[model samples]
Target: MDIKVLGPGCPKCHETERLVKEVVAELSVDASVDKITDLMKIAGYGVFGTPAVVVDGEVKSVGKIPKKEEIKTWIEG
Candidate 1:
């Protein structure tokens, strides 16, 4: 699975990244997590908000931090 966390290296972005890493480790899921800081790249995903979560190329959440349980579902899905 592929998980992309979009932000320009803000505090929330770092928190989101940390949560994702923790969740993945706890679940022992095989996935690649990337932090996207480029505006062009984030815009290409059609996300206008920071701290967005994209799972498997699908926009799952935007503008706010998502819970670990929620993210795990996206990963497992």
Candidate 2:
């Protein structure tokens, strides 16, 4: 699984990144978690919001912080 957390290094962005990493580690999922802090790169994903979560190139969540269960569902999907 490929997980990308997009933000411009805001507090929520950092929290989202930490949450994703925590969930991945807890579940032992074989995934690469990357943080996209570049504005151009984030926009390239067609996400107009900060603190977005992209799983496997799909925009799972955008503009707000998602719940842990929501993230797990996306990863497990």
Please name the candidate that would achieve the greatest lDDT relative to the true structure.
2
Question: Candidate 1: misplaced stretches above 4 Å?
Answer: none
Model 1: per-residue Cα lDDT over 33-59, one tens digit each: 999999999999898688999988899
* Worst lDDT 10-window in candidate 1: 68-77
As a TM-score, model 1 comes out at 0.95
Number of backbone-clashing residue pairs for each candidate, in the order shown = 0, 0
Clashing pairs in 2: none
Model 1, residue 37: C-alpha shift (Å): 0.5
The CA lDDT at 52 in model 1 is 95
- In the range 1-77, model 2's lDDT, one tens digit per residue, is 99999999999999999999999998999999999998999999998788999999999988888899998899889
lDDT of 2 at 68: 92
Predicted structure with the largest TM-score when compared to the true one: 2
